[model samples]
Target chain A: MIFPPDSLEAIIFNALSETVESMVFEEVVINQFVANKWPQVENSAWWACIELFPPPISGEVIIVVPDALMNRFTEATLGMGDEPPLAEENADALGELLNTLCGRLLAMRVGPTHTFRMGLPKIGRGDTMTQEGNNHKLVDCLVEDDHIYLVVPNQFWDFNAD
Target chain B: MLKILIADDSKTARMIIQRCLEMVGVANCEYVHASDGIEALTIMRAGGVDLLITDLNMPNLDGKGLLLAVKSSPKLTNTPVIVISSLVNQALEIELNSLGVNSIINKPVSPVKLLECMESIMEKGFIS
Candidate 1:
């Protein structure tokens, strides 16, 4: 249940990269993991969350991405060209992406022996963002020239009350 | 034409699975859509559904729940189900198999893999 920040960040990066490539057909590059010093963490970022299961080891994954990248992501997933973005569609795409990413990460971590049932993904505006707790681990990366941050809470804890 | 029902909360995932079915030369099939397992069960109860392709995670009634329902139904127990999900586990696989699931497909499901699974299932006398 104790995942070092650096190790969790690396896992998130790999999961993000694989999920984007397979789901949206986009080759994402991880620029670097910006630890605790992400200035662009706000910027009206779109956020998606997928909650994990199985007690003490349970935690949730939160993905934060910029608006422009989300537009491109939605377009790529639906095989569309540049156009006015549909907010709802982009949000749905992000939710599905995180679902796949979290599943892949858990499958890798648990090695297929244990089952992790992830809850449905939730998406909303960036203002919902809160300060990370002691168990929160985060990493900032660049994909398609846009910055995205991914966070996982300690022990799959639900810090936000819905 | 075969009547296949595909259930997934994500429209994109359902679309991808349908596209794969066509790519595998299941080109002459009729597709029914549902967003959750409850809807899928309702559709199946209406009868004439040749196959079921579903996702494990959904808002109302998940894939496992749907499988349990289908297996317990005397009229629908013979219908083939191919589960396509992002989640995978050895224990879950065994449970699904015991529930009479024809095949298990992982998400980001490829046309080739789906084609192989469908062909194998069809060979077992499920398809006409």
Candidate 2:
């Protein structure tokens, strides 16, 4: 059965919202429209990539957030909101957060009966994170004024492309 | 002090679970950590793990395999296993239940929920 586009969008949004609130202690609302450009801070951005296989679908879910947001996330995960951010810690937190988001999103989409195999999460920063070819799909959820971008690369969606 | 085994490929995950355990007032405890299910099983065989908390997706042997290995073992059958994963669906939940898993706690785990599971298992002695 083909899932409705609107339903898929809502599922992605809900997954992102729940993940951010639980992991980063931040609340966000998904925007209906797409953003003009990627969220970045002084030429730097953070991203986490996860690959999903079989079941309801197979694709890669990539989450990109601004450097400032990464700092806050690092602080929140470590329970030291006042401390300076650590690079390794920030990357690990982002990777883990994306991993959770991907898992929850897949579950919500397909239910408990069908299980999906998720690959280990990888994190990247700055220019290298937003390479120009296949970063098209986006799930833009508002976090205050800033936004977190979730991308499902085109290669993974080709199976369902009509 | 109770002996707890935490298995996840991510160091951050293992750390967070450990912190949550402490926050839930599980102070008198010793932790055994593993980066994957294979390592987790190795630790389990070494003995002394009162509780097993694992993540579903891992490099080798995964959570499902680990659970099966535990259930089939004579010595490890009594040890309760708590799964913490993001891949939770009704189908997965039912499967885990039938497999004799103690509990399934989703990723980005909530402290309150973790506490509740710990208390329930500690009081009841096991999920089954």
Candidate 3:
């Protein structure tokens, strides 16, 4: 199906913008939409993933933040001065952040009450997963000129299963 | 008053939703926040939301998982649901229907559309 691409981009940006501004206390412009290729299986670079299982339908959302950026996000988001919270140690918070951002995008698409069940956010530096679904695609965004990579899995949701 | 819940992994998302809702004249409504599916369910378990406005992808439980949980839960079964996502899958829409989702709205949500959705759901909520 042909989804509304521009609105989708706006949704992604709207969500990120709010979060970024709150954390940094300054508004940030989400840069133009960029697309990149991603993997399905797990990989070694530290990454955070949010899974949305829409019943018989399922999709994968991955956010790969370079170790350094992850640190900056936590610091800026949490208003950390320095010697900031470690991404590994702050996995829960980071996971929550990614999940929220992803949720905004999904909310606009799936509608309220049509939410997927969130799982415990996983944090690992290495163990690359490189696979792509027909529905799977990539969205590259620049927040405050900071690049953020997102993977939107193109998985066909099975509506027939009861 | 419209009872709305914004469930997403991002604080940014919640804020956006909140602003959109307000911009759409969703005033005097009680808005709640959930970090993930679990938190969303926790709120519902205690006493469900009249309408669930959420994202498909999230942490602690993605949007789809949350839908399943709601469908399975006797208390939250009737709660209206809406999904927002960057990836809109036709097949996934079918799957959501199987799960009994009331509606599916694609992402980059606008204040105008959100009002339409809320109005429709509110009308339905009142009927039942």
* Best model per lDDT: 2
Number of the predicted model whose DockQ against the real structure is largest: 2
Q: Assess each model's interface with DockQ, reporting 2 decimals per model.
A: 0.70, 0.72, 0.09
**Model 1 / residue A35 / CA error / Å:** 5.7
Q: What is the TM-score of each candidate against the true structure?
A: 0.87, 0.85, 0.50
Better of 1 and 2 by TM-score: 1
TM-scores, chain A, per candidate = 0.78, 0.80, 0.69
Ten consecutive residues with minimal summed lDDT in candidate 1 chain A?
A153-162
Model 2 segments more than 4 A misplaced: A1-6, A32-43, A130-136, A153-162
Ranking by DockQ: 2, 1, 3
Write out the backbone clash pairs for model 1.
Answer: A58-A155, A58-A156, A59-A156
For every model shown, the clashing-pair count is: 3, 5, 81
Error of 1 at A127 (Å): 1.0
User: Compared with the real two-chain complex, what DockQ does model 2 have?
Assistant: 0.72
Query: Which is the better candidate, 1 or 2, if ranked by DockQ?
Result: 2
